[model samples]
Target: MNIVLFEPEIPYNTGNIGRTCVATNTKLHLIEPLGFSLDQKEIKRAGLDYWPKLNYEVYKSFDDFMEKNNHPKVWMATTKAHKVYSDVTYGSDDYIMFGPESRGIPEEILVDHEEECVRIPMFEDTRSINLCNSAAIVLFEALRQNHFEGLNLSGELHKLHWND
Candidate 1:
């Protein structure tokens, strides 16, 4: 699975998400005009020295990303949605896109991919979850639904046991 961040603002959140990608062996794509430089101390601090170890790609623009990836479908996480994330069947090649903290994706883009939009269930009056946390929650569910096979850590499958 892939994680795509569109115009992310917070360095620490991006750093945290980068670390998540590294740990899960997921490819991370950052769409640009980022609020801070990639080498910003705040990003490196949260991501730590292992940031370099993560498999990540930087796209100059969303158009550039679409041109290259051409993902069959993109599952966008938005609050203005009727369907829950668990309602859809996630594929291995699907691109899961998230928007900036302050503002969600533009109306044009969201409307363009309206059929693929999804939202996590939440209690009333709650705004949204943290970017990194939301990404983790969605990604793990996608992986789980796919039986958690074919992932980089699959080889260590035998090591996963339930003590309970």
Candidate 2:
């Protein structure tokens, strides 16, 4: 699985998402014109020691990304979409692209690929959800659909209480 962030601004959110990517064995992609530096302390602080473990890439532009990757199935997450994320089935190598914290993917791109767009179910009153949280929601759903093929899972439960 892959997570692509277009013009992400918040280092903390990016770091959290990066950590999530490492934990889930998903690849991360960041488009150019980022709001913060990758070396910023906040990113490392949020990502902790797992920063080095994250598999990611930086693209100069969206067109450059599309040119290089050319992935067969790319799902763009946006608030303007009609399809619920859970409605679609995801493949292991499918690319899931997200927009920046402030504006999301470009409207032109979204309009061009409207059919491939998805959205998380939320109350009608709310404008949107957190970027990292939204990514987790959709990414995990895909993982679940695939029975967590490459992900680690443990059947053993760590009991929080002893016999009382």
Candidate 3:
């Protein structure tokens, strides 16, 4: 799967998302006009040693991303969407787009792709969740739908047993 961040503003959030992408084997796409430099130290601090392992690309613009990606199926995450995120069956190669930190995706873009938009259900009191949390939530669901393909599912069991 792929995670696309449009004009992300926060360095720490991007750094956390990059770490997630590295862990999940998901490609990260960052659109231009970013608020922080790619070489920002906060990003390195958040990502730690795994920052270098992040498979990602920087795009000049949304149109540039579209042109290079060959019209891949896109799923936009937004608050105005009707469908719940988990309701849609995600594909391994589907591109999931998240808007900037401050303002969400442009209305024009979301309107044009209304059918493909989704949202994480929440109480009306909250406007939205943090970018890194949102990305992890949706991406993991997508990974779940795809049966967690290309992921390491097994690790050494803990020494203590529940039955003990």
Candidate 4:
């Protein structure tokens, strides 16, 4: 799975997302004009030991990203979408894009790709979910649909054997 953050602001959030990407073996794309530098201590701290293992790229602009990535299919994550995220059939190379923390993806962009926009179901009174959490929810669902390709299905206990 590929997770794209456009103009991400918070280093902590990006770091956490980076860790998640590493755990899932997913690629992460970060658009430029980021609020924090990748070298910031907060990023390494939040990403923990997994920071170095994260597979990610930084793009100069949206057009640069689109061109370099060959205009791959992208699913926009937004609160304004009428489509439920789980309803879409995600391909292995599809990208899930999230907007800046302050405001979401530009309304114009969402309008242009309205069909590709999707949203997570939430309480009517609630405003939104945390960026990191939202990304995890949709990403895991996509992974689940693909039967968690390239992922460890189960784990073993540290002090005891599974057969024990």
Q: Which of the numbered candidates is closest to the native, going by highest TM-score?
A: 3
TM-score versus the correct structure, for each prediction = 0.88, 0.93, 0.95, 0.94
Instruction: Flag clash pairs in model 2.
Output: none
Over 46-145, each residue of candidate 3 has an lDDT whose tens digit, in order, gives 8888999999999999889999999789999999899999999898999999999899899988998999999999997799999999999999999999
- Give the lDDT ranking, best first: 3, 4, 2, 1
Tens-digit per-residue lDDT, 1-164, candidate 4 = 99999999999999999999999999999999899999999999999999999999999998899999999899999999999999999988789999998897899889988999999999988778999999999999889988899999999877867696
- For 1-164, candidate 1 gives per-residue lDDT tens digits of 88999999999999999988887778898998798999999999988877999898899998899988864578989987667888899998788899998997777889888888889888999999999899999998888888776656535445656795
lDDT of each: 0.87, 0.92, 0.94, 0.94
Candidate 3 global TM-score: 0.95
For model 2, residues 1-164, the per-residue Cα lDDT tens digits are 99999999999999999999999999999999899999999999989999999999999999889988974577999988999999998988898999999988899888888889999888878878999999999999989988999777777877876766
Candidate 3, residue 60: the lDDT equals: 98
Question: Which scores greater on lDDT, model 2 or model 3?
Answer: 3
When 1 and 4 are scored with lDDT, the better candidate is 4
Global CA lDDT computed for model 2: 0.92
**In model 4, what are the clashing residue pairs, if there are any?**
none
